[model samples]
Target: MANIRFHPNHDLLSHYACGELESASSIMISAHLDLCPHCRQKLASIEAEQASELEKSEPAALSPSLNAMMMEIMAQDCVDIPVLDEAPASQLALEDKAYPLPSILQRHNDKIGPWSRLPGNIKRAQVDVSGDSQMNFIYMDSDSALPEHTHQGQEITLVLAGEFYDENGTYQPGDFIVQTEKHKHLPRTRDGQDCLCLTLLNAPLHFTSGLATLLNPFSQLFFRR
Candidate 1:
């Protein structure tokens, strides 16, 4: 069975499935499900349970006049809010850039959300998912090795594109790696397109890479944020 591994990102999954997540988050998860069957099954189960509950406890019928009034209101409320400004147009193009990794490998980021690019190596960026700091999205350069880091809470990493090898196994697109609070892993991606992933970073990531972390305990600061 698809158990809740990594962070309990089920709420984020639920939000994405129910059309509550931003476009970027939804697209990233959709790509992940294309790879990992276990998470897909879990999401299916949750959806089924929610559907059953709604069917069992839905509200009673509304009057015909009430329906008519609702319809009228909807018709009157039809309006197109602003979407792409000049800055967002460039941002959109950036997401659509399909960087080639190796051996004909290709990956692209296409999601509609309030996404802000983060600084990193070439072809790497991060998307913001939650305002409440529950979920996070991190993008990687193909074949790049992420720095070894530890987490305070559970850490869930779902591969959206490309492949990476770690202590567990070779995680391709859609495969999820669950990490506990006490676990530490170093992941190295194989040659190909860079892997895109959605990370439910519930806690701060403690940097354990190189000699820097040994010298400074507070070098990593996102958790403190």
Candidate 2:
């Protein structure tokens, strides 16, 4: 089980409950919800609240004929509903290591692209979700580091397995972290520990500091498909 620390903001959760987020963002949140019991409870609360509001909006009494039909249906004997077998959980393989995909990703497994090497011991596999944003699975090898950078737009990352740390703090599984243009930091893994994360970026990353600045061109590798 993950020791979840970060979570999507309440506004995001509200939008998710209402089915308002874009496809890529929705998948990110759904994956986080799978790993987070807190968010699950919050979502249930939001759903219940929405249901109540819907009742308030249409405060109409059911007609006698409709009420009778409902009563008759309720009185009918219950029939056994066939239960479909659940698909086996999907696994993402990286050499000798395999990580179980979240439930949401399993449904869209075919959309995941091949993993490609990235600079600084990172590997990325694009997820072909709809909308303008880009989604990818990022794997960081042990003791690996990505150069310091700031977001060109918004970047949302959810730790799927293991952990990584930045100047701000350590992120464990189920951490839903968001960084905007104003935030800048270097992300790396510790000596023995590695990390697997699902990340969504609205724009390419802007490399900052040292020789890494030359890597600005490399950002396109992550941005364009």
Candidate 3:
């Protein structure tokens, strides 16, 4: 069981209704919605809205050379590529835990694994990496400040450290937070054990400053998750 953090100013459940949730957001909402059926129906109503929107999108018209060119491109496809030691099907099934980010991340932040030193007081190690999603564990030194940044989608930050606060509130060990597009915060950890967190995000931080925006193009190619 996880402690619930509610926001009075923001109706976070509204994000669920807007279909703006990432994987982490979906899981959090699922558990909470299960406990509250009114929100569950709200989710259903949201789904219906998405369906209607999808039905109304204009389809793109393909160029006259599209089919023939696609056939030519496919005909030249190279074969005989083999991968070694793929992850087991069980691991890919995502049945391991309901709190996958928290469980996997907290266990490994105690010691380093692969992800290395990044700027600021943050050190990250990627644990679960697949095609569309990435799971990283972060450790922030006390008195460290991670610069203000926005995210490509949603992120689940599970505090495994002493305590950290942004414009929001302090997060301590066992505190799980879902950060969506609507939420942008600068975090800091001070006066205690190093703040460690499990951050599962769909994409990398999109720096939101004028100077940062100029550097965004490079970041997408290299710093992308």
Candidate 4:
């Protein structure tokens, strides 16, 4: 009963479960999975199918010489391998309120930069991911609105708290929205309804209207790492 109205397609979920998606996209999908039980169940079914297929396609047996070599390798003296300790989970705090992050993002607490104000009534915190893509936590204050914009590449937004609406539809918590160059809309929150979202953008946003188009040059400063 998450009331989730949006989700990644089956192909995307399959790619995620098979470890075929890039790091940034995988992180977005993982975070979405944290909030969506439906996707979790679908992922489990995909994994089971993959396991069954693996079993069916498994090679028959190792060659005798290869088995002997493997045995010898296993019989060799064991070297001490140091295992790194897991990082402690951390909360995302804003305006004196702390929010629990998705499990996949827990370790990245240290990577999250301090919040910074953006144009409009929005605030953003960049997440240090190791890739060309950029990830951010975008918080919109109550009754705030972002200028109409489109994407140059692709963008994925996951609503973590509150709600936001655009030409497409209203998105509640646990909603997974994907937009590309073909989409354009103005996103906003209603009175008393602020919103927080985790977003992954492969390219800077393209401001598509009136005075907001003047912000195109500055868009790189906000979105590009």
Please name the candidate that would achieve the greatest lDDT relative to the true structure: 2
How far in Å is the alpha carbon of 191 misplaced in model 2?
Answer: 0.4
The lDDT, on a scale of 0 to 1, for candidate 3 is 0.58
RMSD of each candidate? Answer: 8.5, 3.0, 12.5, 4.1
lDDT (Cα, tens digit) per residue for candidate 2, span 63-127: 88886886688689999999999899999988898999989988778999999987789998999
**Per-residue lDDT of model 3, residues 1-225, tens digit only:** 244343211356667666666655554455344334455566677678777885566223446578567557757969898889633322111123222333222333343246577666677776544345566667777678776778878677766446688998877655557787888888887765467665667766777754556656776564454
Task: Give TM per candidate.
Answer: 0.53, 0.89, 0.51, 0.86
TM-score of 2: 0.89
What is the TM-score of candidate 4?
Answer: 0.86
What is candidate 1's lDDT per residue for 1-225, written digit by digit as tens? 133233226887888668887554465466566545677788999899888887666334657888687667756956898976432212222366542221111223232234454323334334434443344445666666766766766666776556667776676655656677788877776667566655655566665777535533553454433
**Runs of candidate 4 exceeding 4 Å displacement:** 60-89
Task: Tell me the lDDT of model 3 at 98.
Answer: 21
Clashes of 1: 5
Which 10-residue window in model 4 sums to the lowest lDDT?
A: 54-63
Candidate achieving higher TM-score, 3 or 4: 4
Report every candidate's CA lDDT: 0.56, 0.91, 0.58, 0.90
Candidate 4 local lDDT, 1-225, one digit each (tens): 368999999999999989999898999999999899999999999999999997676434878888688778867999999999876667899987788887898976888999998777999999999888999999999999988899989989999999999988999999999999999999999999999999999999899887889888887786667
Please report the candidate that would top TM-score against the real structure: 2
